[model samples]
Target: MTSQQHQRAAGKRAFITGAAGGLGSATARMLARQGAKVFLTDIDGDAVATVAADINRQAGEKVAWSAPQDVRDEANWERLLAEAALAMGGLSVLVNNAGIGSLGAIGAIELNEWRRVMGVNVESVMLGCKHAMAYLRDAQPASIVNISSLAAFKVDPDYTAYNTSKAAVAALTKSVAVECARQKIDVRCNSIHPAFIRTGIVKPFFDKLGEEEATRKLVRGIPMHRMGDPDDVAYAVLYLASDESRYVTAAELVIDGGARAV
Candidate 1:
C-alpha cells in the first residue's frame, strides 16, 4: 500500500511500568525489537536501568531508556511521564504493567494488605492514564495496555484481593477507553490477562515447592499443562500497543494457556 493509503503510525514511543524484569522487561524488549523506542520504569532503579541498557545494546543503538518510579504516587506519575516524553521526543504508548499477587481469603487478608494491592495494581493504572493522557492525545491514535490477569475473571477464593484488584483494572481500562472515544481523543485503552506466567513474582512458589513440584502444581489448573513464558504476554502487549490493533480498545486480551477455558 502507498503511504497515503497506509494505516496511521503505531505511535511507537512507549513508556512501560514495572519494567525491571519479567513481563515488563520482555514487553519492553519486544517493542524495541519491533522498532518502538521504549522508556522502562520500575520501583527497582538499578534493575530497570540494566534492562534498558541491555535493550539498547541488543538493538545496536539507544532504543530504550529507564527511570525509577513508585506507580502508586500521582506526583511520580506526573514527573515521570514528562521525563519519558521528553526523552523519547514524544510519547504514544503507555503500558501499565506494574501489579502484585496476593494469597489471602476474605477474613484472613489484612485491610492494609488489601489496600496495598489496590494501590499498586488498580490505582496505579488510573494514575497512569490520568497523567499520560495529554501526551497520548498529542500522539494521536495512541494506546494504553494495562497488565491485568486471568484471575480477574477466574477468581480464586484465596486470592481475593489480587482478583479484586485485577477486576478493578479491567473496569478502569474500559472507563478510560470509553471516555476517550466519546470525547474523540483518539487514544485507545485495553487490558491483558495472563495466567501463571513464569515471572519473578512466582519465583517464591517455585523456590518453596521445588521447580519440578511447582511446575506440576501450577500446570494442574492450566489446560496447556505448562506455565507461560514472558514472551507470551509480551507479544500480546506489543499487539495492543501497535497499529495492528488500531480498531481494538477497552478489550481484555487473555494470554493464558487456555486455563480459563477449563
Candidate 2:
C-alpha cells in the first residue's frame, strides 16, 4: 500500500451505524478501500448484510461485517461494539451516521414525533459515544465521527425537530472532544455537517416538489449550485477516521457545497 493509504486508517477497525445505504454505506466502502476493517450496522439486517458482502467482494477480502442495530437502544450499542471489537480484534473508529429527517413544523409536530427524532438523531450519538469510548480509548489514537446536518447551523421552520436534534449532536461532539482531551486520551471526537447530500433522505422533497423544481430550489440555495454526492461526505469521514486527523478534534467539518456560507 502507498504511504498515504497506510496513514489513512490501515488496519484500523471501525464501527459505523446506519450502514444500509446512502452516506453510511458510501463511507463504509471508502474506508474499506482505504484498508480499514469496518463493522456495518443498520436497523435493516438484510440490507446491511448485503452492503458488507459487497464491500468484501470489492476489496477481495473479509474487510467488513454487518449486524442489525437500532441506534436508539443502549443495549444494542453495547452488544454491537463488543461483537465488532471481537470480530475486528480492536476498535479505532466510531461513526454515528444513523438518523432520520423531519418535515414537521415545530408547532405542528406531535410530542411522539419530536421525541422519535431526538431519540434517533440526538440520543443515539450519546449512546454510541458512551458505549464505544472504552474500546476506542483502549485502541488509542482513535476517532469518533458523528454525522450532524447543516441544519444544525442553518434553520428552517419545516425542520424544527431535525434541526434541533442535529444541533444537539454538534454540541455533544464538542463536549466529548473536550473531555477526551482533558483526560489525555488519544481519542478524537468530531462532527460532520452536510447539506442536501443526494441521499434517500432528500427523496421526500423531490417527491413533494417535482424533481426539476426541487433540484432547482436546493441548488439555488447552495452557492455551488448543486447537491452533494454521498461520496463527498464519505471522503470527509475517511479523513476524520484516519490518523491524519489526530490533532483535529472538537471540529465541525461542513460539506454543504457553500450553502452555509450564505
Model 1, range 32-76, lDDT digits (tens) per residue? 877788999999999999999999888787778999999999999
Give me the runs in candidate 1 sitting further than 4 Å from their true place. Answer: 1-11
**Which stretches in model 2 have alpha-carbon errors above 4 Å?**
1-7
Best by lDDT: 2
Q: Candidate 2, residue 63: CA error in Å?
A: 1.0
What TM-score, over all chains together, does every model reach? 0.95, 0.97
Q: What lDDT would each prediction earn against the true structure?
A: 0.90, 0.93
